[model samples]
Target: MKRFEDKRVLVTGGTRGVGAAIADAFAAEGAAVAVNGRSQQSVDRFLATRWGDFHGIPGAVGPRDACRAVVDAAVAALGGLDVLVANAGVFDELPFEQVTQEDFDRSMTVNLGGVFFCAQAALPALEESKGSIVATASDAGLISYAGAPAYSAAKGGVVSLVRSLAIGFAEVPVRVNCVCPGNVDTDMIREAGEASDDPAAYRAAAASRAPMRRMATPEEVAAAVLYLASDAAGFTTGVALPVDGGGVAGFD
Candidate 1:
């Protein structure tokens, strides 16, 4: 159960949702976790009563300088970086043709560009520790989502970036992989529900679309990421693991 004992892990955007779950999981397993968020106040509020071994570094991952600063502080706090969960991302529903440049850029900046910057910043310490990197992508990255062009494209780019890192860092002893999730019941999902105007009905409709007739939990996705980042997945680099209540299994 303590597979991550003594490891130093970083979870970007760890203030909420899947990122918070990933940070909590690592801390539960004895890793020294750095919960990275955009605001110190928010991070402090999140850790107000949190248990286990963890620290906080407030920095937006989308900016290169901020990513480096956060990584540096995390490494200094934990003494090194053993694993990274690139879980910071944004989702929006926009028609492909109508998606504005701002929308596309925002998605790419926070999702794809943030992954690149944060992962790059963590690489040196990870290389030294011979650690692993797990990216949080989406099933939309694997399949087309009718009204999520920017989000889908950004996630797809994340998948590609993870693969490239896996191959590029093969000789560095650092593994890279991605977890593609589907309809996790997080606040983000709630926001989507509100956007649809009928929360319960929208949630039900989304759940029914999946074979399992239910959405996954953030913990489920975090568990998948932990597995991929653990020693148990030593040979699992470059894979896009789907933790989606079988939602992605039907993709052609």
Candidate 2:
């Protein structure tokens, strides 16, 4: 049988990029997936095209009420929940001198706050199913990235939060883990490259910086999420598994 046959899953910020890849992977593995996005339009667009089997739950993950609503909706739609992938986040690149209160708040709210509240809201259903949670952190969480301090801080919180939740949910027998990816080839990274004065040079520099000599694909990161959520990782919890091409192995 396929690995996740008959399972139910919810993936936050799943309309695009790595989240979308994770959602698609679950669906392909025979799981019923509910995908959450900030807007109904984006969710509808995704479902109407490549991911029709996925139920789209449109809402922001930052607010506690929204996270609760999204999780409730997913459970109702899928009949139960087996996995929750808290992957909604934003990234910014700016000098520390230019970092504003708005920047820091937005980073923490969407990245760290989203993961916390989403998992909290999903806890009851997860306990019932003895399910698992896989959060998308970043290599920046393990090691600092010069231009994006707020992002690094938020993801670092995610890494720590996974550990706490793993222990917190031990009695419930729910596993919690996280994936820390390095540079990835996604629209987010493409936009970052376009923002640079020398787009091609910026892209090249990013690839060269990774020990693998290239950025990771979203599918590659999704595979890690799959393992963490599957029976293959039944004994694993509270791990911040790195999918970073050894980028975090040494200082850059």
Question: Model 2 over residues 28-140: C-alpha lDDT tens digits?
Answer: 99999999999999999889877446899999988788889999999999998999999999999989889999998999999999999999999999999999999999999
Task: Give Cα distance to truth, residue 251, candidate 1, Å.
Answer: 6.9
* TM-score of each model, in listed order: 0.96, 0.97
Collision pairs in model 1: none
Report lDDT (Cα) of residue 68, candidate 1: 88
Runs in model 2 deviating more than 4 A are none
Clashes of each: 0, 0
Q: How large an RMSD does model 2 have?
A: 1.1
lDDT of each: 0.89, 0.94
Estimate the Cα RMSD of every predicted model relative to the unseen true structure: 1.4, 1.1
